[model samples]
Target chain A: MNWHLIAAQLLNGLALGSILALVALGLTITFGLLGLVNFAHGVFFMVGAYAGFVTFQYTHSFGLAVLMGALVVLVVGIVVERVVIRLFYRRPPEDQILVTFGLAIVIVEIVRAIFGGKTQLFPMPSWGMGATNLGFLVYPNYRLQVIVIAAITLAAIYLVLYKTRLGLIVRAGIDDSLIVNILGIDVTKTLLAVFVLGAMVAGFSGVIDAPIVAVDPDMGASVLIESFVVVVIGGLGSFSGSILGGIIAGEIISITTIWAPDYAQVMLYLAMALVLILRPQGLFGTEGRL
Target chain B: MMLRAIGDRSTWRVELAVAVFLIAFPWVFPIIGGYANLATRILILGLFGIGMDLIFGYTGMLSFGQAAFYGTGGFVTAYLLSTGMLHNTLGALAAGTIAAACCGMIIGYLCLRQSGVYFAMLTLAFGEVFYFLENSPLAKWTGGENGLPGLPKPVIPLGFTTLHVQSNLALYYFVAILFFVGYWVARRIVRSPMGAVLRAILENPARAAAVGHNVPKYKLAVFTIAAAYAGIAGGLLGIFQGYMPPDAFSIDQSGEIIIMTIIGGAGTLIGPLVGAGLWSYLREALQNLHGVGAFWKLILGLLFIVLVTLFRRGITGGITDSIGLFRVRRRTAAAHVEEAPAVSGEVQP
Candidate 1:
């Protein structure tokens, strides 16, 4: 393939990876730290998108949309954690999966009801709309912005987890939830914050993704499956793993599309299967976890 | 020793009841607010759900891609019937079933090698592949986006009078018969020694393997059986609808089946019928009701969450458990001849 085509595809991959990384960040942290699978995380992403879409509609401002989407989903995440999810913490992993799966259905259905089944389109901000000319290749400016935004968000999360007190507690709890519990730390509040934060990321991804992809109730399901691939590929709880997995998945998808357009999407799973068979713990995953 | 003997008898009774119900459902349902079309749809969906129940409910494998087999079976039957390569309807249906089973065998072999969530994701990937394949490369035979239409109604010829099964009542009876027989067969398979093994696999796969059960073979066997059920159901769907929608292969279709099983009651034969009935009925009702369109799905989704949160056992399980309590009360009283009948009567809800 020519440089233009290759560059274009790489851009697409990186942009897509950014979204995956954003969404998987929540899943990885909650799963990594709290030991909750959070199957409803995708629905969180959808809700965030809807929140963004609505805020934009009302204010006619993209910035406000991101704020509203993130805030609303944060609340939603906490409510979910306090309500249905609280009872499941002590249950079996399978039960957790089932409950969350049911919650996902409920959330998606509610979104569908509130916003019709039609795709909700987010208008790109004036600055994010145009294409950028990169000497030999042309790229969508919106996609490039996504990469920048995603990188910033990733950095922010890294700072929070590595540099903040709450992040320290979460990491400590992740290593030994029982120890934290025995230490008389309010693990509940920490989990609630982490859940909200994770949810906010999912929402943020949704709003950011709106301009690039069609927004709908079922959108989260496909993305959710892909994120699972990312999580599996990147070690389940490793933040760095998610970024790596997301980028690899994005490239795999983009490159596959160049080679075989139809199989592009399917190849993601094939790659996942290959990875699982070869390295069950994933690239950044510890073998002990598997 | 006593528990084993009672378990064996209870299993036999459950199997017998399922058989009788299937045989009687067609004859009895038409009199009770049920249409032939609805019955036919239920049977096809029920057949498909059986496969799902086996994988998700019994084997604890939450697959999100059964539509692959359903579509594959439908396409094969439609292609064979449409091309006139298979004149006999029964023969075509058989071939369709076999094709689906073979596909299941291959996919299951690969998928069952992984456990839990990985298995679920793998199935979903394969499903997406099948969808792409059907819509693209196999479009010529599959009819692509439009899907194959004009599948002829099956006919059964008798010596005295050839039964020309076509039109409303006739087609209903034909489908009813197929569903009845299929349901009866499923009940047998579920109660068989093999079904026991599948259940064991679900309860604790590691322990089951530790006990010397060939877990993978059982998983693969059930997966194939489920696929075969989906295939036959898919074929019946083509026959019943007179056209198989391409959406049958869509992930949405697979998701709907999962919802149905969860709603009705997992690990119960009659659960699918109740689930499909509730889902289809609500969909129609909600759509017909004023001020609701696609939002009906939203309502259903909420209902699903409430159900899962409130009643994991589902409608069939709830009823069965209640009935079981009454039976226990009676049996416990019977064990003590001194107990009064009034005590047992008070226990009934």
Candidate 2:
């Protein structure tokens, strides 16, 4: 094994895994709290990228772009939750999945209509340009920043979910929503908050990932699937599992690329299948939780 | 007696009506601006949607990886025919159908281990696995992004005469016969003892299991059957178009069929066909209209949301419910009239 190639791929995997973790984190939180599948979660990611793209075009400020991306998706999440998703709470899981799937198509088509089907270039911020020499290996500045951004966001979300009172209610709701409602905690507000929070996180990750990957209406499709694999491997609704699953998925894809690039994606699915066979709950998932 | 017989579930009224519609569709559809090709596409999707309805509508298993079987069947049949490895189209189609069914069996086995969202995600992920395999690793056979092109249309040889499906109309007839058969078979399954068990499972898996039905076995069987249906549809698509596109294995393909099934109404059997017709017709019609071409999917998506929210029973379900309500009202009215005359006669006496 070539140490240099392996090391580089490992780092690349970490970067990829971090993004995957960010995306999956949102999905787990929503699934845990609301029991909603949220198939349209990826559309929020795509929307964020487009919002950031439009923002960057005017302001040329990465900070503003990120903020706009998150804010726009947050609003979109609110309207979607209020108008459509709110009605689905009492429905079966299949109904929720179907509605959200439809929502995803609608959102993607709208974006395609506005931006056209062509891939848009999201140029790296001025500060994030050039490579960083990290003693043993050189890495792009934007990618390193992405890792930092994802890590910081993950930490921030952790604090909110664990340390805050709202987090307490959310976690309690996740355990047994009916009981939480019986205790007069107003689970509806919590559900909306958690759903929007998940959407914002997805959108944030989309914008952050814009420079690294192509920004297009359908860009979220792969990320969405990969995150599903991550959520599955980590165990659904397991917070730490998202992180672990994401890294493992990233490593699998990157490392496999060394020998057979085409099989990188196939390897990820195989790993998921293996995990399903060995531990259906996932690495960090609780049995029968979701 | 005749009316009651026609209304009976065992009666051939529904079948006769469906056959009439199938025969009249080609002629009547033209008045509303539909052609043979569009109708044929609808039939293909309708055929695919029958399996979807079985597993999803009646059995309550929502699988998003049906494209795996569809692509498998299409590619296998297309590859066999295009490469001259198979001379007979019917034989190739049979092989493709079997291949898809086998794939469904394996996939269903693993995916059935989980229920609800987990199952949906597993199926979707597994479907992607097939897509990636087809696009890159197995591109030699599948022809990758360009897809497998230049396959001959279907030709059937009997002991006496040969049938060549060379024209669009001929192909439509060929597919229509297969679709009718598929529909008839699906209707049988929906009315079978196993079908009752499937419905019971759908209503309440725990109760169904409590009643001594093998829920998993039923699910697996239906899932496999659905895959077979998808496979045959895929084979027909390849033969109809004379080229198999790689996107046949895509998530969109899987999603579209689901949309069609749901739009037409799940559990209604013929609901999928209605949904396919509406979906295909609208898509074709909308794409032709100025300023509305791109928005057709958007409109459909909105319509889907509305249907799922307000009309979960779907169009067919709604219509059937209304008809049943109307019959009940008429019977009640007649009973009241008869009672009124008897009461009046007693009072006068």
Best-performing candidate as measured by TM-score = 2
The pairs that clash in candidate 1 are: none
Per-model tally of clashing residue pairs: 0, 0
lDDT of 1 by residue, B1-349 (tens): 0111112235556545655665566677667566667766876787788788877766777777799999989889888887878767777888888999999998888777676655666677678778878897778888989999978878555657555667766676676567657666766776678876776677667777988999999899889988998898888888778787799899888878888988887766567767887887678667877888567777877777777767665667566555544454434522311221112123222
Highest DockQ: give the candidate number.
Answer: 2
State TM-scores per candidate: 0.90, 0.95
iRMSD in angstroms, per model: 6.2, 8.6
What's the residue-level lDDT of B149 in candidate 1? 91
Per-residue alpha-carbon lDDT of model 1 for A1-290, expressed as tens digits?
47778889988999999899889888898887667777788888888888888888889898999999899998899889998888877655655777787788778877766776898677778889778898878788899999999999999999999999988888888788898889888978887888788878998898899888868988888788788888878878898999999999999999888878877877887787788778877899887662
Off by over 4 Å in 2: B1-8, B328-349
Worst 10 residues of 2 chain B by lDDT: B340-349
Residue by residue across B175-242, what tens digits does model 2's lDDT show? 88888899889988877799879877777787789889999999999999999999999998998888
- In model 2, the clashing pairs are none
